[model samples]
Target chain A: MGLDNVTVKPHEKLATALAPELTAVNTLIRERMASKHAPRIPEVTAHLVEAGGKRLRPMLTLAAAKACGYDGPYHIHLAATVEFIHTATLLHDDVVDESAKRRGRPTANLLWDNKSSVLVGDYLFARSFQLMTECNSMQVMHILSGASATIAEGEVLQLTAAQDLATDEAIYLQVVRGKTAALFSAATKVGGVIAGADPKIVQALHDYGDALGVSFQIVDDLLDYEGTGETGKNVGDDFRERKLTLPVIKAVAKADDAERAFWVKTIEKGKQDDGDLEHAIALLKKHDALTETRVEALDWAEKAKAALTSLPDTDIRQMLSEIADYVVARLR
Target chain B: MGLDNVTVKPHEKLATALAPELTAVNTLIRERMASKHAPRIPEVTAHLVEAGGKRLRPMLTLAAAKACGYDGPYHIHLAATVEFIHTATLLHDDVVDESAKRRGRPTANLLWDNKSSVLVGDYLFARSFQLMTECNSMQVMHILSGASATIAEGEVLQLTAAQDLATDEAIYLQVVRGKTAALFSAATKVGGVIAGADPKIVQALHDYGDALGVSFQIVDDLLDYEGTGETGKNVGDDFRERKLTLPVIKAVAKADDAERAFWVKTIEKGKQDDGDLEHAIALLKKHDALTETRVEALDWAEKAKAALTSLPDTDIRQMLSEIADYVVARLR
Candidate 1:
């Protein structure tokens, strides 16, 4: 009945292992988020930064750095940089998605306005670039900046791809990578780069983060159809929003004549009515879309773990391997 | 009249002097604004980039570099970076301002949507950072990134300061610097740094840009109140929008009890009746606020010209000096 009997999540375990560096990252984030002239910047940033998410992306940076046997203050800066980028994207994403709730609270956009969200988000992105520059590594600057471009490009792609019925698996992958994986991979890759790890090891870390991000996103999308209210998202939220995620894309790919018209009405034209969620789920299940998506998620999770085999057999590596498993374990 | 009899604008002179480099910058801008996966990126960006604005900020970068005898190719990169950052900010600014028109054309926010504007602006920012990194100068990176943060901070400050009666000359200056002068100064300062100019010369270049930017913005604010038709902005647009530009701030500062109530009702409370613009202008003239604002703008322009005395007296420098004069010349 004690803590020993409970199953601690891999992220929690990783957080525990890297608590000291994580604290430094948080401290740096607080310091950097403050604006001497603009109190609104800090106020809006604090709403998102102090929101109690897992800080998983920054932890990936810390974990990657520690796994590569690096000891440096700059890793904390890089970790904070990753978190800032993630938080900034979250702020903008809420505006772009017109989301009202994030992490179970009113979004910054809702609390303030879209203007605050946009400007404060720009502040954070600029702050993130400032953080990365303090690392003084050209390679790091290139990777992080390149990742920023990819992230923005991906977001623009998602905006265009959102309701289109013709969006395929390749576009879905690109959008997912843009919205989620670009930062994830950049987060992990910059950690290794700052550590001066071997190029192969750096690539491996990147691959790990990329696969883990794709798997994590796919699982989250799948949960939109399959979950019973555990993931902070209601079932069929994506369907209600007329989003074309992987499962829906697969379902659409296999749709017959009658099914195509139904999807075109609901997804393409966004003309949903009562029981559309149920019918969408029925079609997804009928085409085995959810099952196939889950299988793909599992494969990506495996690939994440496989990528980690290139690293040294340290405790951090073991924790990372387990985190990959934990990512897909949500589907169970 | 013969071409020689015409009063060629100083910016046109600078453009004629730096045509090849401007061409290179234009070429580079077109190349980098492209996104491999998202055609929307180019479509949205081209709408703004090709919209035939003056391209003043990037020209400052090119002018500064060429004035310093920087024969290298990277100034084109730096100039393009400045333009990209400027364009990015404009896109986001239109969204924040909810502007329908920019440069006498429909803004990207209106042409596409706020979502496209926000995301495409971000892409350009990222692309700007990437372009700066290609210069391989850490000093350039630091200066540019720091300016980016300042620009964002200034914008957030402006947001919180808008419509507030307490916003004074100091806050107005800070906001002006943030919204306009930060990037201008950065564009010029980085050109000097990249040219390996002496620290004194670099400092002077920064001051020149800073003062020029401050003056340029004050004139713009003044134009909103005074322009008949030449400036593209309708007179009293700022007052209509309830924007606390320099004139309003100065006028508010000198307000008597009745005038104070007028400002409180119109600017702060956003309750305006017919003839408010006429009354507002009367208050500005009665209190000499517009005159004072124009004087300060002239003073800043003088300071901008004075700062350039430290640089090598090249033809580009002479054009830059005239450019400073031309910035305020519109007031006459």
Candidate 2:
């Protein structure tokens, strides 16, 4: 759904390149998600795992391993571990966001209840840790567990910071760092670690994933104000939800007396009427916040691409660079 | 609070014997629960942690280590890790159960919101993994993560099996095994593992924790039907919640046609009226379920005490045996 317009989608290229490995990752995820005693565990897990989101994170893991000259099977295990963690977070996020739908379908929280989402999310997270431990790499466990903590801390930070009017860019970066980039960096870093790649290569992969994730999230935020597609989310959904996205934060930073009043009323207090969404968009445009946000996203994408300069020259490396470019391309 | 009246409290003996170590665990918990940016993390965690939980699980970890002749610093870390995991699960449990009062005060979910509880719980879980990794033991990691998965799976099984009349004691054991005993056993087993104890001693500690935990939970469930304490749980709370605890499971097993219809109307259909509580208790009494449940608890307690025969005959071991006996002593 993300790269439909590009004739040669970058992620699709990586997916095709690593198709066999990706298949093993998917199979491991399916095999591990099931509970012997609790049918509901598998039932709830299968609902989201089978929903067909592009397996971008796991592919990054595989690509990093193969590019680093790793041929072992543990990369497959690590890839599956990354996907499990991602799925678990999404499940919990649906409940936190009070989401009714995800990927154009009713969320598990809506279909079953919040209890199932919380427990099953927990189950998957625990399963992810178990998968990582099977690799016999304490470093992998250390890295993944640290990322897990960061991710949770980031979500909690967002919960506290999303509504406050005083949230600045540094705090926003921390929030995004915690929420998105932690897992991205961890996914790629563990791939290299598992492959026994050199520390320099592992660090390069980590830097690449960090930049790509930030760029990815920033583009996503920009798209909320820029386009409305059939990806199950509505235009101005973040606006109505009173989220302090990069665009909104930038707009509010430049707000005058009257405009500041509008942000406080709509965002801080959430007293929005029918015309408020249009008015918010107009303000974002007037402050040039949309264009500046897109530029920042492009800058991160460049960093992601540049991280690959020191890595081995391979088809997967080229595709990863292109993947970063394709992310912010939606905003451009 | 649980052992305030008993003259020879087993946990109190362990606490007195291991005061310095327990202090370290408490300090570590305080230091780790704090979030530099999100102050709400500690605020929610402290409300429960400082409410005086007797630190039973962490104490179990500490005692097992001491009994195995572990004179290292990592045991303190493991004890703190176990406590964090336990606290994290409780926070999520309160949210899942929609519980209002805990420890004679408002639950975190009630005070802040479900969002805060869920995210904060996640933070603690990740923090726990971080602490475990600090101990630098992969076997410890494997045991704890596995237990975490089983714990989540058990909660899910209980969620799905709670209202069904077809649930038997075997299923109940699996649920309790997952929900309660997994962590209990892992807590002690990891202590021995960290201490480099012999495998036989480690196995003994694992068996001891398992039976102790099972006995602990059965006593808890039985007490839910017998006592009303300042602890905030009311008698018959499980019945009101339509939970298929051991007593009710046994009662349902022997129900005649008329009784089955009654159970279906009250528990399955949930058309519970005013005398339903009394009637449920009467049915449990008619089946002599309370006495039989207490008997099962004693059997588990005996198994727990008997398992310690192969381990060192130290003061901690003696206290652990008494702990098992004291668990069922409440029912007696």
Going through the candidates in order, their DockQ values are: 0.87, 0.82
TM-score of 1: 0.97
Model 1 chain B is weakest, by summed lDDT over 10 consecutive residues, at B1-10
Q: Which lDDT tens digits does candidate 1 get at residues A1-332?
A: 11121266888999999999999888999999999999998899999899888999999999999999999889999999999989989899889988888877899999999999999999999999999999999999999999999999999998899889999999999999998999989989998999999999999999999999999999999988998665676777678778889999999999999999999999989999999889989999999999999999989988998999999999999989888888877775
Candidate 2 collision pairs: none
- Candidate 1 lDDT over B78-166, as tens digits, reads 99999999999999999998887887788899989999999999999999999999999999999999999999999999888988989
lDDT of 2 at A270: 92
- The global C-alpha lDDT for each of the candidates, from Candidate 1 onward, is 0.90, 0.89
Fnat per predicted structure, each in turn: 0.85, 0.79
Model 2 Cα displacement at B320 (Å)? Answer: 0.3
For candidate 2 chain B, which ten residues in a row score worst on lDDT?
B1-10
TM-score of chain A of 2: 0.97
